[model samples]
Target: MQFAIENALPMLERTPQVIETMLYGLADEWIYSNEGGDTWTPVDIVAHLIHGEKTDWIPRTQVIMGEGSKTFVPFDMEGHHAVKKGKTMSQLLDEFKILRKENLAQLKTIDITEESLNRTGIHPILGTVTLRHLLAAWVVHDLTHIHQLSRVMAKQYYDAVGPWVQFMGVLGGKR
Candidate 1:
């Protein structure tokens, strides 16, 4: 299989754009709620994306470039939250956007050869995995978080507009 930069860059660019579009106009209170009792506030989700790019994707790419070892470092999302708790939602989102851009830039520089994709790395839990698997999973991770953000937004909309005609219209309910 061909490991081409052309195939990957567009997907990387789309991830942050999708998140930003999905999150437009949401209020701070709604964004920060623990609706599902999960520790991740909306800001935390943004922070998680930023942190994943730094800790997960960058290091993996370094390994692929033969500049670093494949030994994975465990990441604590809750620990990230504690550090990021001071940040405003917009702040976290801005930081995430910047980091995502950097990730895309770094990815573009990678020499995407079949041999590079086939290079193996030992993830602490998953054991050995190829560069392609890591890169694909990074995109999947972005999509997963985008879906999570959308779900939270949808629930907030449902709560705010419950069973009314306007709510029906908002949800594309036909008369």
Candidate 2:
């Protein structure tokens, strides 16, 4: 689908609620389990979303707008591990909701236009990128994790599903 601020905002605004609906008050197994290896748990995904809200998206948008450093700071993809320690899932969800709300409000204040969306910034690793790309990534990033959360949670029933697993595309590694 085409990327527009109007199209993106609704998804962005609903992410917290989506996450909450999927995750809130679940058993510890669903919340804390991972897909093994280095894959993140549902809690980890929420923490990562919180970290992005605090560090990545809006700050980089400002950088593209000439309101901050010319080159964007390197993002720590796994930085959420440290911050989420000793915290409950409810705490992480609450923080993510608050930060996302504030960031969206700040984003709406910017006088965006076609030209502004096309304005550029230097990502420390990805090199030059446009403001439009950053905003689109923010929306898709939420979706990606939402997908991951569902996959991970469903996998919790991998063995329980037994022969039925053949019909479960999520368990088939389609992503």
Candidate 3:
């Protein structure tokens, strides 16, 4: 389907609530453990999402909208590790919710249109990108993490699932 602001907002707006619902009040093992070897735990994913909210989406949109420099600031992918150190998952989720709400509200205030969505900005690595591409990416980025969160959480039961492992794609094909 084509990207449309009307369709994108529901997914963007509901992402935090979906994340919070899936993760909040879970055991630490589910919240903090990873798929091993540098993969993110749910906590890390939440922090990364929070970081993207504060840095990537609307900020880049502003640049595309001609509100600031045409060239985008290079995003710090690992910057959230430091921010996550002292905070609990609950705190991170709350921060994400608030930031997303604010960003979506700010988005509503912008005079975005089909024509405007074609406006371009220079990505640090990818060269020129349109506003529509950025917005579509923002939605997909949220989805990618959400899928990662589910896969990571499911792997917590990887070994416990026993012979059913062959049926489970998330456990790396049953180890």
Clashing pairs in 2: none
Model 3 per-residue lDDT tens digits across residues 1-175:
9999999999999999999999998889899999999989999999999888889999999898876578999999997897688999899999999999999999999898999999999998999999999999999999999999989999889889998988887776744
- Candidate 1 regions exceeding 4 Å error are 1-4, 157-175
What is the C-alpha local distance difference test score of candidate 3? 0.92
Q: Candidate 2, overall lDDT? A: 0.92
lDDT of 3 at 171: 71
Off by over 4 Å in 3: 172-175
Q: Candidate 3: how large is its RMSD? A: 1.8
lDDT of 1 by residue, 85-156 (tens): 687767766777888898888777877788888888888788988888888888778878877775555555
Q: Rank the candidates by TM-score, best first.
A: 2, 3, 1
The number of clashing residue pairs in model 1 is: 0
Lowest-sum lDDT 10-residue window in model 3: 166-175
Give all candidates' CA lDDT scores.
Answer: 0.73, 0.92, 0.92
Clashes of each: 0, 0, 0
lDDT per residue for candidate 2 within 50-148, as digits (tens), equals 999988999888889976567998999989998799999999999999999999999999988999999999988889899999999999999999999
